[model samples]
Structures are given as C-alpha cells and as structure tokens.
Target: MRRRLSEYGLFFRECLRNFHATGAIVPSGRFLASALARFVGNGPAGGQQILEVGPGTGAVTRRIVAQMGPDDQLDLVEPNDRFVEQLRQQFETDPALQRVAERVRVLHCPVEQLAHGKVYDLIISGLPLNNFSVADVQGILAALTGLLKPGGTLSFFEYIAVRRARALLSGRAERARLRGIGRAIGAVLDQHEIRREWIWPNLPPAWVHHVRL
Candidate 1:
C-alpha cells in the first residue's frame, strides 16, 4: 500500500515537472491496463516477445506480467530515470513481476531508440501522442511499427475527446499542433487500425486502439 502511494506521488511529481513527456497525473487504472495488455495473453504460449513503451511506475506492467506466459519475453522502454528505477525495483520485488523477472529487461531510453535487431509480437504503449509535435508523433509511430513483426499487434490508448477539448481552450498554435497530431494518427489508422475499444471508467475516459501490422 505504501509503495503504491509513493509511486503515485512520484508519478505526480514527474507530471508537474514534465507535462508533455510524463503525460498523465496518475498511473493507468486497471481497466485501462487490461485493455492495453489485451494482446499479451493471446499468442502462442512459448515464443512471444512483447515491448511496453513508457511504462510509468509499472501500472500496466503489472497487468502484462500477470498475463505473460512462462517463456514470454518483455522489454520495457522508459526514458525517465525515476520511473526506470521504480520499474526495475518492481520486477525485482513485486510478486507478479518477480514471477517473470528473468524475462524482463527495463531499458533506459525512448522507444524510438530501442535496437532494431529484435522485433516483438506485441507492443503496448502508454505514450501521450497528443502531447507531442506532429513530427515526433510520426517518428514514434514509425519506430513502433518498425519494431513489430509482420503480423504483430500494437495496442495504445488516448484520452477521449482530448483534442476537441484542448482546441476549445487552447491558443491557435496549440490547436494547429493538435490538428497535425490528428493527421498523423489518421494516416496510421487508415492503414492498420483493426479495433478501437472505449473505456469509460478511466479518469478521463479513453479509447484503446489496436493496430496490426
């Protein structure tokens, strides 16, 4: 209980310090995590490789660990030092994560910087695409698609109505940036989006997009 509280505190602090990068004020809720990890347990039991980007404090990471197969491998990419350390400790000490500790690697870098040699069957992302510039979002999406296997699935979520709401209150520059993000996402969705699930239980209800490449 105490550990979870401390993790939330740290996450909140990071949000204040780096709103664009940290994204959320708190870690993902259980329903959101489950939706993001929907593909984790569906593959062939033995040789699946999964990658999780921006796993802040391991909220979704716990759900992924719960669903992971004995021989499955997981790679976590997080640029925040505090989050990276917290995730490493969670895998070392948390019961759910410890069960699959040997198969987990917490990389201290952005997902775009992840090596190219290894591709994954499932990629779950907690990145805040709406907070990034158009080019950055495009690069991130390209990197994610590149890391996925031919038939691999990528699951990610964005707060519902965020762009519309932001546009209502933001200045012209912010509105234009949001439109660019929409264009980038639309381009990807036009090509590969397979399903979109809505989770109304989240703080700011979100939509989970599942894309297959």
Candidate 2:
C-alpha cells in the first residue's frame, strides 16, 4: 500500500508539472478510475473497444480493465516514454489483467498521429484543454471525433473552476486569452453533437462531456 501511495504521489506531482508546462491538467487517478468504472457500468452496450488518450500512469487503464469483459480490447495512446514503461511494468504480472495486457496496444505516440480511419466504441481522454490554443483544441477534437464510430461516445473531464481561478489570480492578459480559448473549445465541443455532464465527486471536481457521434 505504501508503494502504491508513493507511485500515486509521483504521478500527481508529474501531473502538476505537466499542467504548468503544457496547460494539460490530469485528473487524479482515483477520480478517473471511479469515473471509468461508472462509465462502463452505465454504458448503453457493454464497453468493447475502448481507446484512451494521455493515460499518464494507467490509473484509468486499470479501472477500464476491471470494468470491461474479457473479450474487450483497450488501446492506449501515450507519448511519454517513462509513463509507457511504467504502464508495461505495473500490469505485467496480474492474472486478471493478463488478457487486457495481451489485448492492450500502447502506441508510443501523440493522439494527433493516431491513424484516422480506425474507430473505437468509447474514447476517454485526460488531456488538459485549458492550455491549448484554439487551433490545437479544434484539431484534437476533430481527430478524436474522427476516431469514434458513429454513435460511439467520447468522454473527457476537465477542472474548469481551477483553471478559471488560476486565470483570475494571475490577472494577466495572456491568462484571460487562455480562458477565452478554453471557452471557445468548449463551445466547439458543444456545437458538435456532444452532451455535457458535470461530476463533483472528483478532486477539484470536473465536467465530463460525452459526445455521441
């Protein structure tokens, strides 16, 4: 348990650093894990082919496996080498995860590079949109939408309050611009045929937007 806590601590610290560096905030593993569980349980049809982007430390990956049936497949897209290595090492020995392990395809690449023709049943993301430029966010959403099968769902969570608070505290023009960019991205997502839902149980709370295409 101590080791597990230490790993999570490291993950959280890395998440903070990434947030500062790229404006990409990662949800807490516990929160993401629980959300994935809930998503699977409430899925219209049981989760079969799932794809995850920015699975920083496999927090949601583990939960996805637990919630999915043995026949399900999970594809993880991660760009960080260290996190990818950690993912491989962490689940290398679990029996229940063995099938998911075999089925798991960890693409050591960015989401933008994922091939366009493939579609998934569900796509979950932990990328922070508050840090991206308008074009960047649009490109990402387009790429994600392209990867989803028609009628498939794409779910993502973000801590809008924290980002807005940070912007207010900074009191800078750049921060304000970023806030606008964030809103624009949200608007674009809303304009798409996606449904948005906010969940408060997450640390710092979050809004989970589900887009069914």
Candidate 3:
C-alpha cells in the first residue's frame, strides 16, 4: 500500500515536470498491464529476450516479470531519473521482484537510444503516444520495430479516444498535432497490428496494440 502510493506521488510529480515525456498522470492499472504482458517471452520459447520502454514505477513491469521464464532476460529503458532510481531500488529491495532481479537490467535512457544490436523477441511499452509529435511517435515506433528479431512482437498502449477528447477541447494547433499523431499510429497499426485488446478497467481506459514482425 505504501509503495503504491509513493509510485502515484512520484508519477504525478514527473507529469507536472514534463508532460511531453512522462505522459500520463498515474501508473498503469493491472488490467492494462496484463494485456500488455500477453506476448512476453513470445509463448514459452524459454530463451526470450524482452524489452520494456517507459516503465513508469514498474506498474506494468510487475506483470512482465511474472510472465518471464528462467531463461528469459529483461531490459528496461526509462528516461526519467526518478523512475530509473525507483526501478533500481525495487530490484534491490522488493521481495516480489528480487527473485528475478539479477536477470533484469535498468537503463536510464530513451528507447530510441538503446543499442540496436541487442534485438528482442518481445517488447512492451507504456509510453503515452498521444502526448508526442507525429514525427517523434513515428521514429519511436520505427526504432522499436527495428530492434525486434524475426517473428518478434512489439506491444504498446494508448488511452482510449484520448486524442479525440483532447482535440475537442484544444486550440487549432493542438488539434492538428493530435490528428497527426493519430495518422502516424494508424499507419503503423495498419501495417503490423496482429492483435489489439481493450482494457476497460484502466484509469481512463486504454487499448493495447500488439504488432508482430
């Protein structure tokens, strides 16, 4: 209970400090986390290499860890210093996470900057795509996809109708930005989406987009 509250407090502060990067005001709910973890380890292949991007306070990562196999390894890429620190601390102190902590790695950097040589079989992301520019979203998606091995899966989420709702209350510029992001995401989904799940229990509802390459 204390851990969960601290996560919310830290996430809210990060959101205020940088809305563009932090994106959401709270950590992801369990339903969304479960949906996103669907492809972790890509169906018990054992030696799976998994990657997680923007795992704020590891809300979703907890589910990812649970789905991991003994031979699987996990890599986390977080851009926020505070979040990175929290992840490191969790691995070191949280009993639920300590069991697999040695197999997990935390890096303090954006997903785009991660080394491409280390391809992954499954990649899950908690990035708030609606808050980024179209070009930024495109680049991020491309980078993530490029880092996947053949038959790999990339999973990410976006709040349900968030862009549309925001557009309705924003000025012309903000609306344009939102529309562009929609198109960017649409193009990718049209090309690679193998499955999608609607997580109705999330804070504001969300859609988990799963792409297979």
* TM per candidate: 0.97, 0.82, 0.96
Candidate 3 lDDT, 25-137, residue by residue in tens: 88899999999999775555557889999998999999999988889899999989999999999999999899999899998899989974889889998888888888898
lDDT of 2 by residue, 56-116 (tens): 7766777787787756678889887777777777668656567568778888888989994
| Candidate 1 colliding pairs, count | 0
* Global lDDT of model 3: 0.90
- State candidate 3's TM-score: 0.96
**What is the lDDT for 196 in model 1?**
98
lDDT of each: 0.92, 0.71, 0.90
Instruction: Identify the candidate with maximal lDDT.
Output: 1
What does candidate 1 score in Cα RMSD to the true structure?
1.0
Q: Rank by TM-score, descending?
A: 1, 3, 2
Off by over 4 Å in 3: 41-46
lDDT of 1 by residue, 154-195 (tens): 999999999999999999999999999999998888999999
> Which pairs of residues have clashing backbones in candidate 1?
none
lDDT against true structure, model 1: 0.92
